[model samples]
Target chain A: MSNEQDSVSDILEDNTYKYGFTTDVESETFAKGLNEDVIRAISKKKEEPQFMLDFRLKAFAKWKTMKEPEWPNVHYPKIDFQNISYYSAPKQKKKLQSLDEVDPEVMRTFEKLGIPLDEQKKLANVAVDAVFDSVSVATTHKKKLMEVGIIFCPISEALKEYPELVEEYLGTVVPVGDNYYAALNSAVFTDGSFVYIPPDTISPMEISTYFRINTEETGQFERTLIICAENSYVSYLEGCTAPQFDTNQLHAAVVELVTMENAEIKYSTVQNWYAGDKETGKGGIYNFVTKRGKCQGDNSKISWTQVETGSAITWKYPSCILQGDNTTGEFYSVALTNGHMQADTGTKMIHLGKNTRSSIISKGISADYSSNSYRGQVKVGKNASNARNYSQCDSMLVGDKCSAHTFPYIETANSSVQVEHEAATSKISEEQLFYFESRGISRENAIEAVISGFCKEVFKQLPMEFAVEAQKLLTLKLEDSVG
Target chain B: MLEIKDLHAGFDGNEIVKGISLTINKGEIHAVMGPNGSGKSTLAKILSGHPSYEATSGEILFEGKNLLEMEAEKRSLAGIFMGFQYPVEVPGVNNAEFLRMAHNARRVSAGEEEIDPLDFDDLLSEKMKTLGMEKKYKERNLNDGFSGGEKKKNEILQMAILEPKLSILDETDSGLDIDALRVVAEGVNKLRTENNALILITHYQRLLDYIKPDFVHVLSNGKIVKSGDKALALELESQGYDWVTTAN
Candidate 1:
């Protein structure tokens, strides 16, 4: 890299790694390995109910029988299950009551990430849950949320407090054996955020969950379930961060969302886990997640937006099943891959009812030796008469060495459905850069402004806080890769 | 206030501009007329510090500063602007916002008060009106779907807003209609003052009719072979550039 590019990379790395802090919290960690006995031990440790244990054992059996998927367009060394620790939770998490009771080092990590749980409490408009490793340390805005018939708590606590609700909806949409990663998540999942919006209610504020993975050689298995009742609306945001390491880590999560009649659910993610070395590609997270939402009643809507700029190898496709007539779905995303990163991310819009409609806008930026792809599918069943869908997938390549690809699959069983898909791939032109530089803009600033513009459609879909962070992350990833 | 001494510039040492020298006073407008491949655009690109053009041996003094040593953006900050023949399209970036950024970059370098959004809106509106452009054009992406005339007008609008000390218009009037040419010339004329100079490089005399130049130079074989006053443009129009080539 040139000296100027090196400086740019330094600035980006410094900003993105602000939350890479290590805490000294006492923790109960499992041994580094995997087996049926280990899965049974985890079930016993969680003190899970009999049916839940049976469900987990069945998932484990399925996972054991299934082989790893080889169709993600990613390359990596074999993942030896015996080398990965399945569970680790901070010991102080059991004693946490309020934001003040949380560990200072852990709280400082949130502060460095520009999210102060105490301040969020004061705002009274945002409910926050901070998840470290396999446990949720603190949850705020509980009182206000409780007053409105809303149930917002950790998944572990929710499973204990509301077993009936959990049993009714758990694994209904995205079953344990839905995919390889989802099956793995079902077997040894530890903790995640859970939210339920009651009927005839408009959620007054946005709820967010910030996830951190700190333990070495361990995997984070978070399961998020959200149920929005009839005429209810909720917007939820998820943020993830991890410290730098020279050894590969694993993250397998499952997120299931249900929206009833006239209900709307907006789910956004800002994923910024640590990426491995740029030269040797020594370490980073191998994130494989399955997230899906279902519109179960008429006039319901689900919108999924994400900004992904981390992980050495990322494979996630948050999808929507439009089962209700006149239901709507939208997915806007900006996925960036730098250094030795590889990302294969897009959404599946399944139109199962009449008059269903979906729109997708995906923008991918690849720099350095990275590879980025947008793999999307739109399926219109025969019952989905007159369904309408529009998709625009664009990829921008920063350097000559990087690659971007688009794989769009469209299936229509109903001849009356309207489907239009557009795809484009382009690189930054020398003339364009020269034009901007000739107008007194620096090279870095010019590139940044251009990228920001390219991602404007997707960034506007995120919440205010995540939008800002996503913009900064975009610049950081682009700079680091080019440098 | 610009001087070029024995400029020898080319791409990959082919020497498109063999040896050229010229000087322009602050308020003067000089028109360089030549046939195709006569190195008129090459000279303008070199003046604007295009990286593709390598100066084999030359010295460009802008306000008594060594212009060749500075970067392209720094040269722009030092008061130089070029209206390209085919302006670039920057998708998803609002035209007004980009102009404001460029304008502020220059202002910040000059130790002047930077322009806020409100002030910039006002300034941009007035300039658009002077260029006879619609108000709604500001919110659209920069040159994304602009026609040939609109693109040239937009370039002229940027020139008007930037108001650089030295402005080079390379074939800015190539695809413009009579009315666009008039409005563009008017915008250029309004930006001209005692402190700014203009270089209008064109093959035809149509643009010079609207904004007369102090000197008209006919370039042939990478060198300016003849120089005259305003009438030379009309002469070249009545008699094609072949006349200058045959006379030489």
Candidate 2:
């Protein structure tokens, strides 16, 4: 028994989150609290146009009138919005024209995170927009992307360079008053990626945004928007990580995508935020995100594939609206929770167009004392004749102490719609482990094989490089989960 | 190559393989026949280092090494293979990939380079051909949705890939049709060599008809009651196990 105890401790010690170290750099952060003055100051700091400020003011008013919903399957202490600094950014002297002008300390941080932003080390065929705290530091492959009539830059830069496009499609999909966190994000969101693909042209390379949260007490509010014009296609990737802190940090981000006629937008995210301490669960990120895409034109498609493996309490549902005839919407996700983490995530497919089709495949893995839930909704409007939806949510438990739940809601206004939902819960039994061990495979490798197999469908939807990273990340996170 | 002395093991504090002693050597095939609840499966499990079975007071030496002290995977890496009566189905894990991982584990332990997937595919194809298995089994998940016969054949397929020095087949003939049993038995026979040993645990002598064993032992109440050559199996099949238990 003592030897068993020692081995368990060894596993726990070796499984510490690797990206918990904070980078020491000079930063300028706003005072703790949210008010009209803070919003005005944020706009003034970026020299935003009047309409942008008015948009913030309207969102703030709506946010003040709304209350944080208490419906998610997660429990935590009340968040003191007044105690959070809504804006934080690394202090920079002047605008930079190249990675050379960026701070070396910040550059080293991204490099350590395996996302090199410098010219010599930048990833080939993939442009990156590296965001630290509340601002985007550097964007790679801007010239090459610009050659094809593509606009890939930070939202702050887009606000100045292409304000017309931003205003035209900013909150069209997810309105300002969509939800509590989304409304708050709309009010004080600092920086995120902005992508615009032109008509009849496919982007030459993948566009990615790597977000890192460094400041301890400041909340991260990032708003990302991607728009695909007629007959165009684009695939975007997002990766996020935060430094470990004893006090939980809030990260409320909103991502919206719009696809026009004969266009498609594929969005993938591999979120590995700090999930607090595994024992006491004292600190981690409180991720409350709202992401949705709209298929606004005939024959358009929108797909969301996410691998969520972090955050102490994750409440997110990346959804889609099939608004045009013959449109398609897909959501493939693999969310894993360990330690004292809790995640309630899934997707929503609203079919309003004739012959629209949607599919949802979500895999949730829970270990330790975590709680994982899959909540999804499939709705078909009266006019959506021949609408179809298929959803399958599977949950795998690593130990007896963890739990899994599924809540699926379906509504159909017309009798012609077809909807299907399937859910299964399974445990990684001792027998299964023994079977692998008796075959010469170590327990760690066995768990890796089983988990990677479980996530294969969702992983296949990710980009090539991102799928590899997601596999490795899942393996590392589940090291100490099994006995 | 293998020796067990006064092996006393069981799960949940209930002694099942009580006071069992047996010795197996290279190039020899031993058939341990027994009735239901006579500890046939328990002995096989204890030999392979199953976690649930605790060896209370006994010693198992595999090539002069303390087999009881090794973990289940370590025992496997040390060249011991157990063909389960009920092979576990691992969904979503490709069968060929699982075989490759098992094979590579042995190679890495012997300080040899791991076989790449392309080369492994060739090896697997050849092994499957010898077993009369279809190529689709290579792409399917490990035993997921496989029939009983298919599962048994898969066990033999793994044996061919791992190439263990000592193999224990626990009731491998059960639940297998005549055709599958013949294919599986033939597969096992082809892998037998002078440097490797085999132990077949069975309730009936039907399997011994295909692959003749050099030695036969009858177990009752966790102890070997009788030991003989191939004639013993035929005699037991004819006269039944009651006579052997009464005589012992």
Candidate 3:
């Protein structure tokens, strides 16, 4: 078993990042810098309304007054903001009327990534908004979605068609100045998906967005907003990948969800950005994201399910604010870090109304020299009588070099609230692997079985198609980390 | 169908199994009884191809194939199974699903089509029923949160599912109650076939009473001091291992 472990570690040391190929397409990029002029240029480039510009200016002003947070349990060299290109997009001759008008090079790039945007190979039931670099290149099933009274398109298109709706709920959930990354995203976010499910209606099909970062030095700041009206339900998924570069790239994204009376929103993310060089950890995406949802009406629900298996460094906390009586909030996450990667991610559930409830299940798997942590908070306010919260965080360490940590905070001002938190740290033992082997299962299959079991609770929350893909993605990421 | 010659195995530069020679034929059940630290378990580990336990100098042949040269999983796929004394608890892995995986591994190795979940479920249900295991065992995690007796039963259930040609039961009867002991022994008895052999490593003669052994060997100080029929087990139980070790 020890010999096998040694060989496993050796293989992991040589594990390659697969999605590291850059697309060959002409791109229009901004000069490397950040300032008021850059914010104005970005807003102007999108041809936004005056209110949008005002929003960006406000966020930029707030961002100037704030500083990058360093409290997360990760370490990296200081980021020179002025050295990163704020925006980059593939050059487009004109607005695309259909997938046929998409550039062949960009289409081939997406096809290579297993996300075909062409009509002949589009995902059957998933309406995808494929964002290339800094702009959405194509949005499939828009006509079908519109017939069902559902609004699904890029945020830039939504701003042009329905500026009032965008203005009303853009930063309502996560404020413009909520955090450093959120503020930056608000100021320079190029393109992301916008979803609006009207009252008394469920989405006809699953809505998803595939984000691809091609340029080496450009920063990707995409914004996603979902609005579920009264008695409505919507499930949204997002997947991201980036080309490998020797210089680290920045990806600061913001996602907000608004659920009205009796509405439900399910948001899932499978982030597989290029995770630098396995041995040197030279280049990868710095994923800093802020995602939050608000249960604004009674009996509303919000669920967040995320699988983080990429990115060199990740600092994200998808949270929920239960502000309505009898509302529910749920979070399920599987964050895996390998080969010099570091991730500090979890959720926050704030119970602010009577009879509010929340459940959190987080599983972190760390391999090689990576670091994985689960930081979560559950807060019940004085008015939140009968509030309940249950949190369980488990970590699995693959080798002796990797590390895992859990930080859970629970605060309740009301005595009637009930909060339960359970945490456990486990290792993939040689004995366990031997047990599987003695039963005829190979070591690789043994590791996969154990990992899938560890992440079962979280994977079950994902949509059917995504659950299978997520399982494969996890196996691919941890392929050589263990025997 | 299994042969071990002068197997001197140990871990961390310390030889625990000084020298063991044994041959098991089809339809034969061999019982090895010894006190603590007598290397009974080490022999089982060496046979199972555990990496930590190195065979300093030995030869193990299973079906005329060099077993020491094969990886643990390859050894298993070649019709060798080991029932661990302490079954590992794999949380969230469904027991039925795990059984199917192991069974499918063998099937694939033998160039057969994998059995679907529905058919596998029926087969597993029948096996569990024969072992007196409750239906909940199918849905529960593999050996996770299972009691001592339940863990032992799960090992046997896996053995029943895989149906390996040679099974080395390393203290499968340990920590089992009387009722559980009977169920386990009956389960083993039903699995016995002319094409398969069983090696039961035990520290007590009590297990021998339930499932009679064709050959009983008394091991002391890493060497088999006495070898005989089932009567030797009764003699050892009555006179204890003191007489055999003293005479040797």
Candidate 4:
């Protein structure tokens, strides 16, 4: 059995450096910079409404007053926000009415990321909205989704036809003044998928948004808003990947979710960013984002599951605020950091109403001098009587050079609430590896298998497409250390 | 056939198996009996290409191939299987799914087509019956909450399904009752063939009573000190490993 693990680990070690290829997409990227003019120009290019202009201006004002958060346990060279291009789009000569009309360059980029733009493309049994840089390039299986009265489209279009619905849900969960990145996202966000499941409806298909970074020096700021009306159900998955590059890039995005009475929302993310330089740490991505969901009505539920395996620096926490009686919130995460990358992430479950419940399971893996941390807070308010919360955070270190930390904060103002937290840190055992290797799995495949098993709890939450991609992403991040 | 030529191995630079040499031909069952901490498990691990065992000096050859040079999985693909003393539990990975994956990995490496789900189901059912396992065991997580005996039986089931040329059982009877021990031994015996080889590592002669080893060796202080026919196992069973440790 130990031999089996060793064999599996060997297989993973050889194939771990994938997702390092850049696509030859014909993109029209702006100059490397950001300012009031850049923000205004982006809005002008999108042909924004007057109200949107005002919203952008207000968000910019708030962003100007907000300081970059220093609390996250990540270290990257100071991001010169002024040097990042705020907008970039592919060079498509025509407005694409279908996948055929979309540029081949755009299609190739999606294909390279394993998201083909073909009409028959089936990814993990979910409909995909492949967004490259700042634009939604192509959508898959729209006709089938439309049949269920599920509105899944780019946020820009959602603001047009479903204006009332968008207006009501937008900024309701994550307001413009939520945080530094959220404010910046509000000011210059480009395009993201907007999903609306009508009352009493269970979406027949899983909705996904695949983000790819194409041009250099461009910051991809996408804002996603999903609303599940009363008695509605929806599961949404988001996946992001970028080519290996030598210059650090910026990706700041915001995602907000709202679940009304008796509604349930499950959101999952698989983040595989290029983890810049392993030697000098010259490039990669600085991913700072805000994501939150609110249970606004009684009996509503919100769950967040994330598998993070990439990026030079990641500082995002998808949280849930239980504001209604009998509401439930959950967060499950598996974060892997290799090379010189660092990730400070977890979740916040705020119990504000009576009888609210929350559960959190966090797993962090650190290899090759990387540092990973799981910092979370679960707060039960005074009115949150009879609330229950449970948290389990575990960390696995692949090598002696890496570090994993767990910092959980629990506060209960109501004595009737029950909160329990547990944490454990361990390394891949030599005995475990030997057991697998003897069974004939290569060392790399064994490590991959073990790591994959370590993350199974969170990976199962991802959509089929993202799950495969996540597994591959983890393989790449931990490949070199398997031996 | 397998050959160990003066193999010196250890962990963290501390020698566990100083200098050991052994050879087992096809269709033979070899048993190595040792006391606790006598390097019995270490030898089994080294044979399976475990990375921790730094073969300081020596070589292992499996079927004319440099066994030490091959990766763990390659060894398995080359018809080597190790039944663990204590199996690792992989949560969320179904037992049947893991078995199929392991089976297909070897098949692919051998340039053979993978078994489809239907074929796998049939193969699994047959093996399960030999190990006294129910069909439902296939869907459960790999040894997630399996009892000690069940885990050992599951290892035998894996060996039966894989049908490797060389099978290494490391203390497979450690925590099993008499009934479970007999069941596992029977499964091993059922899978035995002229083209296959078996290496059983145990602390007592009780398992030898069922599997009936062709050769029995006494291992002490990281070296095999005595070798004889099956009667040697009975002598050790009557005397004890301590006697052999001091006799050497």
Better of 1 and 3 by lDDT: 3
Identify the runs in model 4 with alpha carbons over 4 angstroms from their true place.
Answer: A1-18, A22-34, A91-103, A118-126, A139-150, A160-165, A442-445, B2-43, B54-69, B83-166, B169-226, B230-248
Model 4, residue A121: C-alpha shift (Å): 5.5
TM-scores, each model vs. reference:
0.91, 0.94, 0.94, 0.83
- How many residue pairs of model 1 clash at the backbone? 0
How far in Å is the alpha carbon of A357 misplaced in model 3?
A: 2.2
Candidate 1 lDDT, B9-123, residue by residue in tens: 8886689898899999998999999999999988988888787777888788998998887778898898899999989888877888889989999899989988988999999
Q: CA lDDT of B177 in candidate 3?
A: 96
Chain A TM-scores, per candidate, are 0.95, 0.98, 0.97, 0.94
lDDT of 3 by residue, B1-248 (tens): 99899988889888988888999999999999988898998888988988888888988889999888888999999999999999989887888889999999999999999998899989998998887778888889989999988998888899899998999999988899998998889989988889899999999988998888999988888888889999999998889888898999
- Model 1 residue runs over 4 Å out of place are A1-26, A119-124, A442-445, A480-483, B5-21, B33-39, B54-58, B106-119, B134-136, B175-183, B203-206, B218-228, B231-248
Model 2 pairs in collision? A276-A283
lDDT of 2 by residue, A240-352 (tens): 99999999999999999999999999999999999999899999999999999999999999999999999999999999999999999999999999999999999999999
Best by DockQ: 3
Q: Give the DockQ-based CAPRI class for model 4.
A: acceptable
Query: How would you encode candidate 3's per-residue C-alpha lDDT over A1-483 as one tens digit per residue?
Result: 345666677656655667888998999999999998998998899899999999999999999999999899999999999998988988876677667777899999888888888778988899999999899998888889999899999999999999999999999998889999999999889889899999999987899999999999899999999999999999898999999899999999999999999999999999999988888888999999999999999999999999999999999999999999999999999999999999999999999989999999999999989999999999999999999999999999988999999999999999999999999988887788889988889877887798889998999999988898899788767868663
- Decreasing DockQ order of the candidates: 3, 2, 1, 4
lDDT of 2 by residue, B1-248 (tens): 99999999888899998898899999999999999988999999988878778888989999999998888888999999999999888887999999999999899998999998899999999999988899978999998889999999999999999999999999999998899999999999999999999999999999999989999999999999999999999999999999898888
Candidate 4 structure quality by residue, lDDT tens digits, A300-352: 99999998888889998899999999999999999998878899999999999
